[model samples]
Target: MTGYLVRRVGQMGLTLFLIITLTFFLVEAQPGDYASFYVLNPDLPPDVKEKIRAAFGLDKPLWQQYLIHLKNTFTGNFGVSFGHFPRPVMDVLAERIPRTLVLFLTATAASFYLGFFLGKAIAWRRGGLFEYVATISGATLFTAFTPAFALMMIWIFAFRLDWFPLWGNSCIGGLALDILKHMVLPVATLTLISFAGTMLLTRNSMLETIREDYVMAARAKGLPERQVRDRHAARNAMLPVVTSLVYSLIFAIDGSVIIEGVFSWPGTGMTLLSAVRSEDLPLVMGAMLFIGCCRCWLT
Candidate 1:
């Protein structure tokens, strides 16, 4: 186990290195650097722009800058944010990460619970009307376009019904009830879209597990149907579902960029979008690296 863990860690490190390198070059390949804003300013002279570039190491050669970025990343020195000037990238991310975590983690838990319960029910009664309806609905939802679905949800619930706020996250010291109310739409959207995949996976796994010899033996022993299903079939079938849950939780640290954007939620995904639009390299790189590290370490 130790050797296996060591190998996995090594692989994760290599993958992260590649991600960092590729991200750096791709951002560099964009039309302009972080200094482009200064370059376009009418009041700032060329010399002042040069100084600004030097201050951010934008004046350095591409390879040299890349090396410096790599070193800084390893040392937890993400430098200052271009978008949020005078603030470190880590500080900006620190402010946003908790919001993303709370949103996604809550959604994940709710979705998985709903999916597992429904999947177990449907699979246990495979030939029933419930199975047919659930199978069709789950497949449809699993294949749905996320952004369009999220928008439709907002339209119905927030805009037309006026049951919830239109968009935006809660205030820092807001009422708990207000925070939950604001969270309802985004969480529901995420849950509805994501639960179907889990449902389908669980259903398939349960189907296979129920036909196994152990499951048949449990039934043959005259165990109650519910007991046999729950303790024997569903329990064994949960392995893959649980594994997928781990990956889901890890990848969700990046947050849903489109959903957060659509809802104007001030999470990591929203912050990353703003950073990209403003060409805030340090912030962008910091966010990506943080996400990559989560993916690597957890998976």
Candidate 2:
């Protein structure tokens, strides 16, 4: 396992380096560089614009620029952000990363466990009314588009009932409770979206496991239903679910970019979107490369 992990980490690093290189060039290939913004400013003289370009190293060759980016990335300096100019890219990411992780990780965990138990029960009671209702609900949720679902939730909970705040991370100078209150809707939205898939997968896996030879043998020996299901069947069924859960965790780390944007929650997802819109290559490349590396490592 140790050797396997080391090899995977090395592969992940190489993959990340390639991703960084590819994304950098792609962004650079965009119609205009950051200096174009400075060029369009009427107040800045031609000499001042030239100086700005030189200072930003826009005057450097593409190969030289790439080399500088590589060196800075390895050294934990992601360069200055064009979007939040003068603020280092690393610093901007640092603030948003934690917020996104907290929100997404929590939602992922809640969805997984809740779905697991609910699915297990539904599968066990397959022909019952409870199972039918749960299966239908899960199916509905699975088919629902995330953004539309989030909007519907916002309309009902935030606008109509006024149960939760419409957006933002927290109120100014608010306590922990205030932050939790603010997060409820976004977290719920993410959880419900994730839960549907987990529930369906778990139900199918459990159904197959319960019909296996050992489960029948256990039942033949008159073992308790719960033990036969939990110890014998569910354990074996978990292999696929475990695999799915790992990928879900990785996605949680990268975050739900559109969901965060809709909720007005400050997170890496929103920051990355902002960076891309403003053509902040360093920040955009850094964020995308980081997420890609994380996904590679997890896989």
Candidate 3:
């Protein structure tokens, strides 16, 4: 297991390097530099633009910049954010990442386990009305567009009913209850979508497991129906569901930009969106690379 883990870590490092290199060049190739965005003032002198470029090392050759970026990345410095002036990219992420993690982990954990057990229960009673209704609901949710669904939720819960706060992460140093109140809409949006996928996969896996000879033999032994279902069928069916749960948790670390945007949740996803809009290449690249690492490591 140690040797396998070593190999996997090595592969993750190599893949991360390629991702950073490719992302850097692709972002560089985009039209207009970050300096241009700041050059909007008609009276801003050409020398001022040069100063801005020089300060951020954009005036250097692309090769030199790439090398410096690579070194800094290795040393845990993600460079300064061009959009936010001199603020370090890592500093910006530090404040936001924890919030994203809290929200994402909470939503994913709740959805994953709930959906898994719900799926198992439904699978055990496959032909009942409850099973049919749940199956249809899960299928519908899986097919729904994430951003649109989030918007619908915001409109209904926040705008129309005003049950939850419309946006933001709540007041700083606020009570835990206040923070949770603010989280409801965004968490619910992610939960429902994630639940659909988990439930369907779990149900399918359970269905397949129950048909296996081992399950029949367990039943023939006169074991209780619950034991046959839980110990024999559900145990084997959990393999695939667990895999899905892990991937979902890892990717959820990236957060949902659209949902965050709609709800104005100040998390990493919202930060990434702002960085992209302002053409902050360093910040954008940093955020993307971090998210990519999370995904690659888990997969």
Residues 105-181 of candidate 3: C-alpha lDDT, one tens digit per residue? 88998899879888999998989998888888877886788888988998899889989887775634678888888
Clashing pairs in 1: none
Candidate 2, residue 124: the lDDT equals 82
Q: Encode model 2's per-residue lDDT on 1-299: one tens digit a residue.
A: 99998998898788888888888888898888867755777988889998988988889999999898788778898777876656887887777778777888888888898788888888888989998888788778767888899899999999999998887756434688887887899888878777867887888999999989999999999999999888998889888887899888886766567878788787777777777888777788778877777677787
**How well does each candidate superpose onto the true structure, as a TM-score?**
0.92, 0.88, 0.87
What's model 2's TM-score?
0.88
How accurate locally is residue 20 in candidate 1, as Cα lDDT from 0 to 100? 90
Better of 2 and 3 by TM-score: 2
Best by TM-score: 1
Off by over 4 Å in 1: 84-86, 212-223, 250-255
Selected candidate, larger TM-score, 1 vs 3: 1
- What is the Å distance of residue 166 in model 1 from its true position? 0.7
Q: After superposition, how far is residue 251 of candidate 1 from its true place, in Å?
A: 5.0
Segments in model 3 whose C-alpha atoms lie over 4 Å from true places = 1-6, 34-45, 84-86, 211-224
Candidate 1 per-residue C-alpha lDDT over 1-299 given as tens digits, one digit per residue, 9 for 90 to 100: 99998998899889999989988888888788877766787888889989988987888898999999899888999888867555988888898888888899999999899999999999999999998888788778877888899899989999999999986756455788888887898899888877887898999999999999999999899999999999999999999999999877864565567878888888888888888888887788888777777777777
Report the Cα lDDT for candidate 3: 0.83
Candidates ranked by TM-score, best first? 1, 2, 3
Find the candidate with the highest lDDT and give its number.
1
